[model samples]
Target: MKKINKLILMVMITATAVISSCQKLDMPPTNIFTPDIIFGSEAGVKSFLATIYRALPIEDFKYRPDQGFKVGANDWENFYNSASVTGEQVGPFGGMDIGGGFGYWPYKDIRNVNTLIEELPKYANKLGEAKVKSLLGEAHFLRAYFYFGLAKRYGGVPILTEVQDPGAPLESLQVHRDKEEATWDFIGAELDLGYQMMDETNETGRANKYVAAALKSRAMLYAGSIAKYGSVNFVDGLARAQGIVGIPADKANQYFTKAFDAAKLLDGHYSLYDKNSDKVQNYIDLFLKGDSPENIFIKQYSIVSGSAHSWDATMSPRYMTANALSRSYPTLDFVQRWGALSVTNTDGTPKRFNNRAELMEGLEPRLLATVYFPGATLRGLTFDMQRGIYPSFSGTAAAEVAKQPNTRSYILAGDTKTLYQGKMVIGFTGPWTGGDELTRTGFYVRKYVDAAKPIATVDLNRSEQPWIDLRYAEVLLNKAEAAMELGNASDALTAINLIRVRAGATVYNSIDIDKIRNERGMELAFENHYYWDLKRWRNADLVLNNTRFKGLMPYYVFSENKYIFLAEPELMQRNYNFDKRFYYEPIPGGELGKNPNLYPNNPNY
Candidate 1:
């Protein structure tokens, strides 16, 4: 059946040949389907351009692998989650034991962009200068974006400017990686070309001037931050402020200033999505409703008409959840992080609601608005918490499953007793259904799962929810942080307070240091930012030390004073040490075996 399915897809691609709608083809029909010939026509070119913007992540955490560890899915997360999976040097299993997400999408994007770079330029003159140049510019912006992704992940990666000919690909295939400095320079150069080549209003999703500028600023800020914090790259203790290492403080400011300028250009079109008319689920309303003005660049998902998996299965709990698919559980670690929000007092003291229940009870109303607590009796729900029956992960009561507690099982391999947060939050299992144990450290996400279309199906298009990539609110936080980091506290206060004032967040009347950070964690909770944000803030050691996994148990109990749900003594601890090498994931072992000359291994690997 798999073979048949593969064959059908191939046949479909062949049978549905796209034609050039804008101009006449000067080449033979055979050339029409060639990479160059196909993209040469205006309509064909537009289609290609559309294709580039269309690929996106439907699941909330594509780049984030932190949840994978929480779910106890594979060795990668196992290592990070438990701090038990160990090894520095590569023998059998030693690469990306810490965080392999860096290697996944960046390289995948590079390969795709390289294809765009190689194919588009050939038909430049033949297709007329303007059209050809526009497409090329889009490609350049995309390449720059890919480079940025790579740069953020691994310090440097192989910089392939062109597509390799399949017949003679070996030479380029085994090319060595570029120096980090050279790579960033090349990327900066690409951004320059992209900015010049693309137009903002005239361009679609493919690299517009504003997007390029925004991207450049983002790049500069990240590079600058890494360099400034001395976290960029290390060599013993000599913080190298040179080359590809980290952007110097002055350069960091320059990038932030540039980012501010680029953002200023976009100041007109975007704003925070504040339509909390329903008001009950305000936190969920802001991020998941999709109508909020806050979302600027979402990778749009048209479920029925698109190719990706519909979100129905993942968000909804089994029985009540539209499909019986497993829920993508967010851990107690994540929940507790948000609880850390109330740690700041409005009166300039730390109020610290470190306990889960206390955090939930004292939590700014925003948290409850976003979650579907078991037995929650808000106007939208009804269920018995003691019976292990609560609102479904899908948020509709009709689809929920009912089971006696002592009987045990939530329709998956994950154990239900691990329901420390799920039981408290949405009141459903992880919304999963494959095996039966249901092993996870957290609960299912209630942020985006709507009650309306609460059934799972093969169809992927559902307009009810639009994913938010970067909302204006995020920008506010981003700007505030940048300003604060750059010593512009007044601007930071204004930016931070906007969100607080709107949410009626009682924790801060104005920007308090702890309050602002807490606000970000709680407001942005489970939009998948916990682990990385912790790393960036340099709080990983304290946080990770407590996050370590043990034996095989999915949940971890922070020391009594730290958290409510504690880990059993028998849980597996996959790794023990936070070796610096664990920070960057090495290229996959599979690729390494193919070509040693590719410098096949991450330095430590």
Candidate 2:
């Protein structure tokens, strides 16, 4: 209930003695709780803080990138996650529709945070000085988090540090947008204050000193990136001239240094999750294990609290779920980013494998752990990801790859239940063209799906996996990127190799910006970072220009009783297009209507 309700802290205390004594109402309502009553005790403060935490704008399991963040249970299409739009996965959707965001405006949430930071200090005597400062620090961290969310979507939003008085002149309450660099500076300053005032440790999922630092590491990296690359992809207009939608190129190193310094603060405070000796299992457990050392800040979910998501239900295959089935599938293009797949022979012919799972052999354990390749098992059932049965095959993979699915020489099955020669033509977890719930890319996301949960019983809103909002892995990536940009190649190499070692992949002896970017893409895949990463790096338009993500279609040859994988365009044939104008999302039309001062909107709306 706390997650759903905004705890305003004004409650009827029902002062019975006062009510009995007063025949006529001469004083303020006795039922009302004052700011002191709310901030004076730990319980009261925690209760109030719960609302702010609930509205923290984390794009977790429930976030639909094509939609906006935090649309919640109503987002039945959430499985079409941010990865879909970024070419990381091929979800059952068309082109880039979310270029203009779903209008995420969180100034109201910011005001609540401001209210806490402003009013809490008055009760310092009631709640000890240290406690009051810590609470205020938490408030600052929250405000920074909210601001970062805004800064990423629309460049420079109105920087409202103090809560605006509703009774004041309308002109006074109506604020104009701050310079993009100024907004980013404000976020950095808030996080700095947060780090200075907060203690080292706090409860899980709440902001501590290091949590603020972790956020700073991420936010400042975005700022640094925008400053460096913002000019590369520019939209000329009044907003650009006014410095409201873009950062100056000269400020790049300043922000990158800030990011680097902030990231360095988290070095020894936390370590990567390395519980298991088996790298693949260890990587898988990094997300599932609740007490992982790598998790810096996580938004927890509990079935008992009724605040759970449908990750397992939406990400797992149709055969593995009782209700909702898989909608998002990893693309071959994204999978190849980690390393080349062994799907083809030296002569460019499709490699014949004894089993579908053998395709995973010699691949990086991290990749295997991130995606459920064909023949991977969940609960007890194999993924069984066969696209269709090929009755006969005698050609190079290139020739086969050239032919369309319908035009190809394979026997297409209507569904998994369709049989050919007494054997199921399509696998249970399928690339069945007949249905939408089946796997379209021959892979299911393995990262956050709880294999411990029984697939026969898996359903929506029952998944209890906590969403790791900030992790040491991302901080390391931030460090690596910043270090590389700052020309500190050695530090960047060390940071990347640290992740590469844990991933069981070949450690790189050399580091470059592209390497760092690729490593970030591979490490933070499907965690809702790639899309934003592309935008900040000013690569979305170039990377996604008429791009159609490919899918690894595993076809079983009935004659040889062996599987041959073919890289082909995804079935939907959806083309991902990111225009230069989409580099900055348009400010929500409603916001502009409410406050004309918020214009001129970002580039082309």
Candidate 3:
């Protein structure tokens, strides 16, 4: 069966708007569908629904910290994301300052969804009652999804349930922000409504009952964390009074229970994708294959319809990529946490490895799947990432030669001692700071890259890999985390072990909050969950205060015929001071200027 091409609908609708906007608003274009005409037909309603889907804040391939979601015609070079901010990974050149404010006020999208909800019922004659209600359910889900995005980032925002008139009094339009608790409750209620009204099966890329439940699972988990872990001390007097940013601690369990229950609803419907015999390959295949049972909700992309991303071009290693270079470099700090092959020895002591290769011998399969270390192969080529080789010398000469610059090239044992040979042999995947394409942290990203795409050619549109928005693995982790927080160890271990077993890791007999958090970090690295996870757990300030993320320098020793790894602070100075006030992003200055009612903005704005 052919895949449902939603991008075609999106293109048609966007084209219509572009043409209509170019002409005068007072005079309707010669041949165009106005808002009224568009909503009057069932096909037109689906077209509008396509627009709503396109505007979702999935934070997929186009997302960057500097620019928000779905950025078009922006420089792809400045592609740093939440992973960079959280110290899970560093950029190719150096560490980036996490200063860009998250100005994600999707009020416009919410308004569009509100307009759809208001109009869908009116066309019940043209579209059947069931179809109208399902569409309305999707609209509610979209609104809840947008509000949830806002509430997570900037606390409570104004909830506009119905479409407001442009000519209405400014005071009436300037709706007060709801309490953080109420906003979360509203999201949960809307998801419940969506789940009830949505069909069990619908068109691909559209939200069904399972999708609604998956969203509810994530939303409730965020709400539960905020209620339990967020600080009440930062609550501003005016903002608190206006119902903007504080949730009582007592309400934690209620939200956690909701998250757990919602997640439970998808128990048998989805399972971890473990089709490949090679565990590492299995983890990699999970992202490449579009029809995995683990994927609950996905944002589909189509190269044929001119809707695609540059993720492959932007993230592949320098040697592998065609135009853009690798941007996200996994950090040494994150790599160490992946843990050695065995956590403990038979005597219950921490396990240790004699050599660098031994250290990497039995790592959790997920770590290998997620990161491309020095010797990993990609697209049929091995990444020989040698910072510098240790020169072969006698006792006194060896000590002097060892003092040479580690970033410079040296002759290898098997190669000829010619100038050209030495230069060509070294720094294949560099730790050199002189260029834009070199890997400064001695690593390249492996996750979310399309290995099937042409690595040597710069074709952005051909990068049609689907972005998995809500995967069942995340839901399972969510269930485990909530269960752990609620002190249900049995349930927590049950959920977590399923993930561990799938990844070919040793299952835990006992687990703590730290174990769960680390597991989540390892499993979901570079998937855009760690940054928010740190914030919601209230550990961002402690973990990232005035710290420099670390990197590994792997150098091959010619005499020993083995590789040696040096773990040290990254060459570039990266000072990351996470101010407590950053827990809630400041309300956008433009929004505040438009409506002073959003006054007394989030603390420390």
Candidate 4:
């Protein structure tokens, strides 16, 4: 059997949590695929394709790019010192670094699927035919997803059906990347094929009519925004959003209807995992459990006892021994963005909150599932954070920091250290005197990681595999979004309320387009949807960098290291409202290297 690169994969995923690279880790093999080795048997096909779902960097919550994604004010400045770009800035794009060694390489997975699509006919009517068809749908859905990623990141990418040869010269590469419009069209069409071929009754995590509908809704949303908001480099690119029109308004409504219907089909089939049903129940526990209804498709992981990528272990805080050396410390601004005090109302609206106690005073149950503050008393423990107990480190740990001078002593704050915008709890301050940074910087991410699993020596099992990537909730949100755009606010309300009530968040919330947007933002925070959400709405620069960036978290600062939000006023100038150019990313360098012909760069680059 081929062994998975569990260690390397874990490392790659770990990098994202440590540093906000929202792209999920993509793993692919170099060998050309053949039906004989791929779909010939259930085991062969299973092993070959399972990795696509498994390799997704979802369990690691830091950069899962959902609506709640955040970049610190100073941290964004840091990113800026690293790159070069123009136009309206998104939260992370000031100097967001790309062209890195690792990225979510969708083409790699698609190549495998394309190979099957091209060769699967040989087994027509074979016993494996059923499985092949299902697998084929999975392949196309995955390919659509990859292209979705491509379209979102670079505004459109080359859609390669077959795997590229490593030795193929650049000139012989023949295919040029598609424009955003053509690619979205191809992606939407491919997803239609996948949905047409899929078994809707399959596992919740598996793709079905619901998943495709959800994807289409997302694609349409992106297309509409980009078409409406044309930017530099393209003379007539404003017409690219024509794809949205291609999928007829009624067509979109039908797809959305199926998505909602499928989700409703799974209703009661899966209930929200609300253990203890208490506001204090840990958030990480949900993801740690395998196959919860909330999870649409999942990837399995374990600590030392069983096999799992280090998605959970690596992101845990320093106080948890497992994470000290390998911490996924969150930026203070991110913690603040998470809002210990309060979240948007059940209808997805935000209200001002100052402290964790106020947030916990009378918060809904679902909001508590993801984050917790020190003042929020639970289990009679009060989950307090002692400021002096955290760590401090002064070395080359932050060697390449773009704008700020690095290294200094950091003592823990009660909870203020990581998100000093003002809160009750204190986590790890720095790498210093008795300070444990991993947990210190990150107060809590209880979305995954099962604490119920009897603690083993080093690893915890009995925990369910992480349904890491896609979820049914997302489908419902997708349905709501499309319904709203299609002018059916009432239908949008129905979809949004279903998710809200599940989280115990639907008390006084209203149902409207703006309300649904906020609800989606809160419900899908950290699930890796924010960048695209911002892009689809054309609000990346507005929300990501402007009103959201709270600058360097100073609560953890000690007398030793000197750090402060330098341009606090400049950093504070966030644009909560969005801009046009913020909708698309520039084409990548490597692909540009391959074909400067079809892949004209988005001027934002």
Candidate 5:
């Protein structure tokens, strides 16, 4: 059998953390640090924990729906992100189907965390009992996190807590799947242990008592949702019979209670960021500011540390960025969910405006913060998003909706050089006649884009804004959803209104499940929550069933000398379809072959 020290080195080498590039760590020889050397001191233990934090399955900006968590640093696949799969945005790639995940099996990382939990107690004398317990609590939080990632994807994965010996018999090594209910119960229990054992505060990115509870608030909400809605997309299979892929609908309230209680524990610990009186700017700064009180937990990055992302370059308008233009454009369908845009008249004729930017007047400030309308400024450049020049139009707005390109009377500009009456027909930053790198929806994403970053410097691997994983807003949303589910409408209304008050939107006078859900969607838009929220609510299939998301097109009326916005199907006319079987991703085929006990796979694999 190999020495435990050898196994420790193997795990340490795979450690990746957001604090710094795992590859650029200035460390001595790996073989020098054994289990004793690693767990003996506070600094050594921190180094070990860094690796565990690095392995967390955070679906941040790097996550691609067609792929999985943590795409390659250089891969431009971040362009096709989770927002596109949902109705949040229409991207250049990846329609509705996100096939059987990216074969994510993190048991090896789980074992490393397990090894720390199992072995750390031996050095309690050197690192005081309180310190040891605290570290162990962090380890438990990590283990629960890894399992949560699996539970959300492939339901009821094997609950492997102990570090199993490799020399054990094959039958002992191959564990059978737990019931889906038991899996969520285990996750809650582990989080409870973390909540009880950890401290109230720690470093920004590190887990603490409140952070553990915050995760419980999020994770238990997911479990409660699965219990209530898992039957909506049920399939008759051995896995269902064994309780591997579906939860009992009867236990939904029990899980909702847990979610509500977990969320309540964080009531006084964090707050919604409200530094700026300007609601729009306050909302924008909430994501950008690292020191905001709203942040429960975040994944830190630094360009100097060589851990950076391409969000700014990929999301910025073509004219705003020097490299890598916009790929995903928000849909008008999603924009309308917040509230109706004032772009149509009472008779259904398209509303004509002297300035195209006036289309956003009297709209929610939160919506304005989330997206850049035609005249919104970024990096000193106004986003001039004009699609075509219509010489004349005598018909209603309904007639122009989703009309074929070649047949429309509107003279669409073929290129940037096309001129109508000595002025460029299409804006430099375009919803142009044809091409990528332009906003097809006549808008751009303003959320999370660093307005302070110089326009010329925006490129791949240049963005270093920290990804806020858990925030106080989400906790409140979770509490609100649970309260609504538990029939406490007053509490639900209060929680929902807190977010709305901060957002400068109209607060609800009454509450229901749909209202609670819509607030969650609007509040958490493009943070990569909508897709999962839809899945847990079992509404993805109904929402995306042959759905063709619409885009807002701005047309310059050449004869009238004004602009009119038209709601039209996106240029590609791509149809997004969601099969019901996608609710739970299929168990990885490789894992099933390795251990037959892991069968039967999820429905319709």
Candidate 6:
């Protein structure tokens, strides 16, 4: 097993109390150490670094659309996620109507990182030069990461490279946001610098050369997409003049090339995890097993250290979860988009299934692995998701008349009964309403669930499963996307085919940008990638404009003794409108109030 270092544990345990105690009193307390005393020791430096790591917006298991990175205990009530916004999934209640906003301004964390970058050199004598450089690299990587998160959400933002004095003038402190291209360039430079300075060898759960490279691959890809596809007309002249939100189209290839190169650097170090013969189980285990080589970087958790999340408790099937509410319902649009599992079809056509039992037949393994469809088993319980049952009309006069609509014809009179005299009847899992735990869509989420954990007895914040943020498969997808954007179709197919083969799906003989995007959506579904992917590709408006995602309803035909499936509009009225201005999230109103220089907040605000 890969070990999470004791340093991380120490940081989690000590930093919260130390940082909190330091700020409790205005004046210097006798118990608290001065900055000089803190930075003078190696352990203190490690502690500081640990705090910064903890502050990072890694967007792990606890990430929610409404809450940003850190989730409150009650935030689970607003359970919609990135998948909910994207057409990939819906919530148990219905479609999430919440406004799209990611108010992430981690200036405090950035300031702390700037302070570390400035103070690290002072400790060079206590820590060896090599160690100091590594520390500096980590600090730089964190800064780059911080900015990248902002850039992806709000375009260019104020780049604070050094620590600012508390007494600094208001004019000096109100730094204007840079142009989008410059900010992205700065991020790339910082990641490159960290990659050059960091050691190839590092302990687990710490930033290494590969981690920096993976981040660069992801950041550069986002930059390239913005340059290639984003519209510049949304912002006003003043915002455009400051370079706050637009990139030149000419720079697209350069960013894509950088992303491709960065991804290629990890070729020998990591590959897709394919240890299990059962491909579906193998895909599930990819998220379940923390020690897999596929995970390039992860945010780990430990119940002993008081670090864990409630992902399984919140996302598991109703019967499986202690809370008994199934959030994040997989959508029929995503299921239909999975296409067929047949390897012989070069055109990527979806296969036809004659009956409900065969509905999942010829589907991609990843689809089966990602979504718990009707009749799928989870946590030792079969999900008998029968919307309703066909009435027994053999001898009745009502049966003699033509069949009514599937919705009106089926009866919810009792549990679904078969012909056997004493046989048990399976209850419907629903497309039902009037309850919290019932699924509005026909399916439930399956990815990122800890199958090993006992969900029925679990409580909040007790799940300790690690969340994989950067992995080999995503890097491969990145490489393929970049290559496709660069007009290298053959190379793109080669990279994407590796992912497809592992997913137990057909390999594409000829591919286009759309095909690559589709492949990415399937492979990385519900991992917090689809929404961003759609945004970066400039396709969200096209895909989600006034769209209501679809769902499937399964009904038991008692006379035929077989289940029949119908695909139609989801049970609930889901409205999704992606305004063009939403491509760039608005800067927080409070931040603008503090500094008027941070004006002209991203278009439609």
Query: In TM-score terms, which candidate is top?
Result: 5
For candidate 5, lDDT tens digit of each residue in 470-587? Answer: 9999999999999889998998999999999999999888999988888888889899999889888888888988889888888888888889998888765788888887888888
lDDT of 4 at 273: 51
Q: Write the per-residue lDDT of candidate 3 for residues 1-605, one digit (tens) a residue.
A: 01112222223454111101011011112322455455667656756666667677886666775567754565344346778777887763233354436587888778778877877777788788988889888778888889888888888878788777666688898887778899999999999989999987676446788888988989999989988888456445666665578788899999999999999988998889989889988999998767788887776565545556777777765667677666667788888786532423454432332333454566778888888776676677777666566553223322332454553345432221222323433455666555556665777777877676666654454576677888889998899888888898898899889999998899999988788888898888888898888778877888887778877766655655555555546645466667777788888888988998887788767
What lDDT, from 0 to 1, does candidate 2 have? Answer: 0.82
Which stretch of 10 consecutive residues in model 3 shows the poorest summed lDDT?
Answer: 18-27
The residue ranges of model 5 lying beyond 4 angstroms of the native Cα positions read 1-3, 12-32, 71-76
lDDT of 2 by residue, 291-343 (tens): 78898787766565456678888888667888876778889999999877988
The TM-scores of all predictions, comma-separated, are 0.66, 0.94, 0.87, 0.64, 0.96, 0.87
lDDT, residue 414, candidate 6: 39
Badly placed stretches (over 4 Å) of model 2 are 1-32, 71-76, 404-407
Q: Candidate 5: worst 10 consecutive residues by lDDT?
A: 20-29
Can you list the residue pairs that collide in candidate 2?
Answer: none
Candidate 6 C-alpha lDDT tens digits along 206-310: 678888898999999999998888755544555666678888889999999999999998899888999998989899888877778887777766565556677
Give stretches of model 4 more than 4 Å off: 1-39, 51-105, 162-172, 201-214, 228-285, 304-317, 320-359, 376-383, 386-443, 453-467, 545-582
Per lDDT, the best of the predicted structures is 5
Q: What lDDT is obtained when candidate 1 is compared to the true structure?
A: 0.45
- The 10 consecutive residues of candidate 4 with the worst lDDT sum are 13-22
Model 3 CA RMSD to the hidden true structure, in angstroms? 7.0
Candidate 5: residue 323 Cα off by (Å): 0.7
From the highest TM-score down, the ranking of the candidates is 5, 2, 6, 3, 1, 4
